[model samples]
Target: MNQDALSRELALRIGLAARALPDTDAKRLLAVLADCTGMPMTESQLANIDLATLKAAGQGEFAKVADDVLQQALDILKNTASEKILPAVQPYEEGEMPNSVRIACASDDAIHVNGHFGGCTWFMVYQVNSEEARLIDIRATDIPAGLVVDDKNIYRAEQIQDCKVVYVASVGGPAAAKIVKLGIHPMRLEAVASLADIISQLQQVMAGSPPPWLAKAMGIEVSERFKFDREAVG
Candidate 1:
C-alpha cells in the first residue's frame, strides 16, 4: 500500500512503526502489512492490528528484535499519536572547539544511543574534544517517497557526511561500508546506553591518548599520533 493512498495520520503511524523496527521503512512495512492483513489496508484496520498479526507478518524478521521494541511498534500502530521526548540541543558555532571531532549518534529517543543506522529516527550530532562535548544538532531521517532501502542508507550517510564518527546500536555491513566510504567511521553498541555515558567515555579516550584511527579523525599527523604510546614504553 502506497502512503499516498493512506490518510496523513495513518501514514505517520506507519512511518513511526517502521522506525521502531530495525532496518525497516514505511514502504517495506506496508508490503508486510498488506500481505498479512490483506491488501489495501485502511486506517481503522491498521489501528486494530495486534502483536500476533504483526509477528506473523514479520515471518522471522522480528526474531532478533526485543519484545519491547515490537511492543513499541505496536503502540505506534494502535495510537493516533505518541509523544517523543528529546534532549535539548546546546548552542554551538563553527570553530567552537579546535581539535575537536564531530560525532553522529543514531538514536530513536534523544537520550540514548539505541537506534539502528539505517532506520533510526534521529541522528544526534555532538562536537567533542578532550575536555568537553556538546550536542550540536539533531538531524531527522525522513525518507522521500519511492526511495528504496539501499538509497535510504545512502541518504542517511549523506545527512552526517560532516561527522568524523557515527555511533549506532546496530548497523548492517552494507550501511557500515557506505558510511566508511564517506569518510565517517561507524561504531556499534548494540545495547541501549545513555548518550551522556558514551560521550563521557569518548572524552576519556581523547583526554589521554586516542587510538591511531581516532587520532587521524581529529586531524593529527600520522607520524605524531603514536608519541603517547612510545613515551610510555620508554
Candidate 2:
C-alpha cells in the first residue's frame, strides 16, 4: 500500500482502540501509537474509524502492530500519572522589578561582544534599568565582521508576547525595519562601556527630550509596563 493508505489504516485502528479505553488510557495508547508510527493521532481520525472493523480484526490481528510495546508505554504513563508527580506552578511576584533594555555592539573589524558569564569574542547584552543598568544575558553568534551597519545587516528588534518594550540589537537590517514598522523603538549603541553608565546616559537623553531625527529613527513612543499575576510552572 501507499504511504498515505498505510497511515490511514493504522490511524483507523488506533483510533478505534483509543475510543474504547478510558480518557487516561486512551491518551497513553495514542502516545504509543504516535511514537510507533512517527505521527500524531488526531481526534477527528479517531472518530472516523469504525470500531466494528477493529473488533473484527481481533487481538491477534492487532498484535501485528506490536501490542506489547504499546502496552508497555501505556503502563509507564499509568504509573507516572498514578504517582501524581507533576510540575509545580509558581505565582507571579508582585510589584514592578524594573524594566531593562539590551544593547548589542558590533564593529567593522569583527562583530564581537562580551559573553554573559565570561568569554571574549562573545555577544554582550547590556540591560538598562530605571535605577541601575546591568548585563542580563549574552550569547555567541557567527556573524562575520567588516559588514557595513545598515537596516539590512545590523540592528534588529525582538518582539515577545506580554513584553512592554521591543528589544533591539544583536540583529540585522530587515529585521530592524520590521520592528520599527510595528511601532517598536529601536536604539543603536556600540563600543564597550559600563552598563550603569549607558543607562544613565539614556535616561539623561530622554530627560532632555530626544532630537526629532533621533526620536524618529528610534520609533520612540510612550509605553507602560504590563504585569501578569500568574503562577510559574515548575
Candidate 3:
C-alpha cells in the first residue's frame, strides 16, 4: 500500500488495538504504528494520546482515517467490553470482494488449525471474501472438562454457531453432530497447516468452480455460478 493507504491502515489498527487491548497494550500498539511509519515513538508520546483528542486532531499519519469512521469505532470499545468488534489480521491481499463468509478454526494459536474439537479453547474466527481472507477474532470457549458428552458438545457448537464453516484436527461424533445440527459444516484438516494457506485454498474454491457441498456452505445458489471461471479450474 502507498503511504496514504498505510496511514489509514495504521489509524485503523490504532482504533482496533485501542478499543480491544488494555491501556498499556494500547500504548504499546504505538510501536506497531511506529514500525509502519518507520519512526520511533517515545512512551511519553504514546502515553499521552487521548481518544477524543486524537479523534479530533488526527495529526500527521492519523489524518487519513480521521473523522467519522475512526470516531465511531473508538466510541464502541472498552477494556471490559464483552462483545467482540471483529479485528483485522491482514490487509486485503487481492481486490476486495462484495460478498464474504465467516469461518471458525479450532486452534490454540490463531495461525494454525490444529486443536482437538473437545479440548480446544480458542476458536480463530476469520472472514473470507472473494478478494481476501483475514483474521477477525480469536474467540474463547469455556466448555469445562468433565462435563457430560452432550453438554460439552452443545457448548462447543454454540461457541461457533456464527461461523458457516469450522476447521479442526478432529471432531468427536457427538460434537460433529451438534455442529451439523447448528447448520455449520465441520471440516477435518491436518494437525498442522498454514492458516493463511487454508484460507487461500478456500478462497480458490470460491473463485473457481466449487463443488456442490462447498457452494452450499458458502450459501451460494448453484444457479448463480458464483463467477466461477471454468477455464481457470485446473
Candidate 4:
C-alpha cells in the first residue's frame, strides 16, 4: 500500500479504537495520523471515535495494523517519517513448520534461478511458508560483470546472509563453503525453472512427506508426524 493511503488507514483504525487503546498509544497513533495526513486533529476528536466503529471495520479495512503499528511506533519514537511500513519477516500459516522461512534466488530475470553465485547480478529474497509465498525484495549485487574480484562469493553471500537457502546455477567449492560457514545452504541447479513452479513444489513438500534436510530446515522433528503409505508396507 502507498504511504499516504497506509497512514490514512492506520489513522482511521487508531481513531476507531481510541476508547480501547491506552491513552499514550491513542496519543501516539493520533499524532502520527495528523503528521501523515497533514491535518490537525485534537485528542477530543480521537476520543470521539468509539470501539463500536472499530469493531465494524472489515478485515480489509485494517489489513496492516500490526505492521503499521510497529512502524509508526518506531517512527514516533525516533521522530522519523513514520508513514511507510518497514519491511520485516511476516507471520506464517498455522501448523507450518519453522513458522516461516526466507529464501534467495540468483536470478537476473527475477523469475528463475538462472545465475552463478559469483557472477550473478540480482538476488530475489522471498518469505516462504505453507499458506503463502511472497516476494520481499530484488537485491542487486555490488559487483558488476567480469570484474573477477577475489571476494565475489563473499559479496554475494553477504547479500543474502539472512536467507536460509540460496538457489543458483553454479557455485565453486570454496564459495559454497563460505556460504555454508555462514549457515546458508546452497542449491545448485542444472536447469532453472519458473519461480511459480518452485513455489508450487515447495507447497507440495510442505503438504506431506518432507525429506530430512527439509524437515531440519523447517525445524520439524522427524517423528510420528511423518506419514507413510500404508499399502507400501511389507
Candidate 5:
C-alpha cells in the first residue's frame, strides 16, 4: 500500500485497540489520539468512530502529534499500575537545590545546550553522533531574536554554520519569521520552573515500562524524560 493508505490502516488499528479499553480509558485515549492526529474530535466524530472507519479514512501515521498522546497514555497506565509513580519519582525538595536535571536559571542568561533554540537573536550549534545531539554550544549575535525574522536563513546559517540547536526566551514576530525559513527547531520555555518540571517528568517516564497504549506498537519507545520520539531509541 501507499504511504497514505498505510497510515490510515495504522490509525484504524490504533482506534480499534483504543475501543477495547474501559469507557473512561477509551474516551481519554480517543481524546489523546485526536490531539496527536491534529484532528478536532466532534461529539459525532467521537461517537461514530471505529477502527474500521478510521482505517478506511486513510489518516495515516501520527508523527508530530503522537509524542504527547503516547506520553499521556504511558502516564495513565503507570498510574494504574502504581499510584506512587509521580511522588516516588518527584525531583522537588523543600527549599533545597533545584530539582531539574539541566536548568538554565533566569539569572544565568545562558541557554541550555539542547538542539532546539527559541527566538531570533540567539542560536545554537552542535555535533551529532548517530543523530543524537551532543556537544552543543549557545551563541548570540547582533540580530534580534524570536519568530518574526526569517527562520530559514537562521536555520541555513546554523546548518551550514554547523550548529545543532538553539535556545532563547524571547523572540519577535519578524525574527521568528526569518529563523523558520532556515528550518531550525526552536525550544521555547517561559520560566525556570516550567523547564524544570518538563525535564523531571521526562526522566520519570523514560525509566518505566511501556504504557498499555504503546505496548503493541512496533517502534514506540519511551525516553529518559518519559517523552516519546521516533528517533529517541537506538
Candidate 6:
C-alpha cells in the first residue's frame, strides 16, 4: 500500500498503534491492518474493530504478542482521543539532595512499570534516597523529526545517563548490556508494579545493608557501610 493513500488522521492512528506494540513498526502494522480490515484503511473501519477480529488477524505474525498489548493497540486505533495522562514533575537539582540516586522507570501510564525498555513512551525519573522518593522528571521517547538515531537502545540509554538504576517490564539482553556499560543498572521486573511501591522497596533496602551492587549504585563503600555500628559497639 502506498503511504500516500492514508489520510493524515489514519496515518497518525496507525503510527500510535504500532508504537504501542513491542518490536513493531508502521509498515508491519499496516500489513496487519490490511489483513484485518482490508486495504485503504480508513478511520471508520478502525473505529468499528473488536479485539476478537484483531486477535484472529494477528494470529499469523503477532501470535506471540500478548493480549494486553493487542488491546492497547486496538484502543489507540479506536479512539482519536486516546491520550495518556502524564504525571507532573517536581523540582530538583544536581547534588541538591546528597546520598540520593536518580532512577528511571519505563512507563506508559506514569504510575506503573508497564513498558518494555525499547518501546516505552516515557522515562519517569525519580530522585530517591533512604528516606524518600520523589518524581523529578518525565522524559518522552519520541525522536525529533529531523534527528536520526542509528541505535535506538543507545539513544534511550543516553537519555538516562545520569540515573543510577532503571526499571522496566521487559528488555532485550543486548539493550540491557548497553545500559549496563553506561554505568546504569538495568532491572527487569517479573510483573507490572506501581512505581511508588518499587521506590519504597528500594528505600527499605537502602535503610538496611544494601548488596554490593546496590551499594555501588548508591556510591557507598561496603567496607564503610557498617562503620557506625562497629564504632558504637566499641
**What RMSD does each model have against the real structure?**
13.8, 20.6, 12.3, 14.6, 19.0, 13.5
**TM-scores of all predicted structures:** 0.61, 0.28, 0.53, 0.51, 0.26, 0.62
lDDT of 6 by residue, 128-205 (tens): 888867688889998889999999999999999999999999999999999999999999999877676688788898
| Superposition TM-score, candidate 2 onto the true structure | 0.28
Query: Worst 10-residue stretch by lDDT in candidate 5?
Result: 81-90
**Candidate 1, residues 1-234: lDDT per residue as tens digits?**
112312454567779889988999998888878766676665445655766777777575565667788889877765523676444567889888877999999987555688999988899999999877877788999976776666879899999999999999999999899999999999998567667668878989987778888888777775687876788999
Ranking by TM-score: 6, 1, 3, 4, 2, 5
lDDT of 1 at 84: 60
Candidate 3 pairs with clashing backbones:
none
- Please report the TM-score between candidate 6 and the true structure: 0.62
Off by over 4 Å in 4: 1-98, 143-150, 227-234
Over 4 Å off in model 6, which ranges? 1-81, 226-234
Clashes of 6: 0
Ranking of all candidate structures by their lDDT, best first: 6, 1, 3, 4, 2, 5
Candidate 6 overall lDDT versus native: 0.79
lDDT of 6 at 26: 89
Score each candidate by Cα lDDT: 0.78, 0.36, 0.61, 0.60, 0.34, 0.79
Over 4 Å off, model 1: 1-81, 145-150, 231-234
lDDT, residue 54, candidate 5: 37
Q: List the residue pairs that clash in candidate 6.
A: none
Q: In model 3, which runs have C-alpha deviations exceeding 4 angstroms?
A: 1-97, 143-150, 217-219, 226-234
The parts of candidate 5 lying over 4 Å away from their true place are 1-108, 111-133, 140-165, 193-234
